[model samples]
Target chain A: MRIELAYFAWVRERMGTPGETVELPPAIADVAALLGWLAARDERGAATFADPHRIRAAIDGALAGPDAPLAGVREVALFPPVTGG
Target chain B: MIRVFVQAAPIDVGAEIDLHDAGGHGASASFIGRVRGDAGLTELFLEHHPAMTEAGLASLAHAAADRWKLGALTLIHRVGSMTPGETIVLVLASSRHRAEALAACEYLIDRLKTDVMLWKRESFADGRIAWVEEREDDRDRAARWE
Candidate 1:
């Protein structure tokens, strides 16, 4: 499936890309699996996902956990939480 | 009534807030968030996607209305470059009792921090610029409301 991935804050800095569209392999069924697969693609991805606990994910603008299904989501954003007041 | 605005100028929090007491609300609570001169920060810039930011603020206001039986609520957030000690955001809530108004004000700010689409960039004295990262404690605070 094709998905648009977005990054913010530290994740965007480390990845050097704010957003991108990509085709995911069939083995990637959910957010956790997708992160694991991406980490193996390059050093930048590996480092970004190095500490999942500090990272947060949103599927189609709604908060999602690592186990959340991404079957119907066309967009997923990853960031270092939010600090806006 | 709830009011939300995003502007480029300084926010006159007190002037923006006025209670006529059409029904005689007995309590009002206001919160103002200012840019802090972080010892580590030499300069700061704020950037936001206009449409997304408006949507974020509207959602926050709606949530506040749904959660609290409020007489009035106001939320103002500024966009663009801001200096240290400048106002960044303000929230006001009025209710029939102090407890509701105070709790609503706190809830609005807390949720805005986590759910808002706004972003801040800080420049350190060493010539490094970076986006502010969200704190775990802020998320925990918002979670309590959920």
Candidate 2:
């Protein structure tokens, strides 16, 4: 399935890009699997997803977890914990 | 109803709240975040991807409306270059009672800081740019609401 991926703050800095649209392999079943797939794609992806504990994910616009299903999601955002006020 | 505005100009939080409440609000609360010159920094520059920023703010407004009994809500966040003492963001909530308005205003600010997708870069006097990290206290504050 095709999905839109967005990066924010330091995550965008490390990734060197803000957002992208990509097609996922069938094996990429959930958020965690998608992260692993992305990491395997290149060194930058690996580095970005290196510390999942510090990273936050949002499926569509709502906060989500790594194990959350991405079956119908059109977008997934990955970024450091939010800090804005 | 909730209104969200993100601009590069100065934000007058008090005036905005007053205007919002002029219609017939009994209670109103607001939060104004300013650039702290004491961050060992000379100036601050904020950048955001336009579409994403709007989407993020819209989502935050929706959350606040769903969580509180609000009569009017407004959030204004500035971007681009800003000096010390300048406002960064403003959150205003109007309700029938002070408790609900206060809680909603706090909730809006807290969630905006912790969940929104805006980015700020601090430039030190020595010529360095750094991304602000998520504060531990912000996380704790957000947790209390959950």
Q: Residue B7 lDDT in model 1?
A: 84
Please compute DockQ, using alpha carbons, for every candidate against the native two-chain complex: 0.46, 0.52
**Residue-by-residue lDDT tens digits, candidate 1, B24-99:** 6788888989888886676666665435567788888888877878888888998778878888898888888999
Cα deviation at B31, candidate 2, in Å, is 1.7
lDDT of 1 at B29: 85
State the local distance difference test value for candidate 2: 0.81
lDDT by residue (tens digit), candidate 2, A1-85: 9999998777888889998998998779898888888778899988888767878788877779989998888999887766666
Whole-model lDDT per candidate: 0.81, 0.81
Clashes in model 1: which pairs? Answer: none
Model 1 off-target regions past 4 Å?
A: B6-9, B18-24, B46-56, B136-140, B143-146
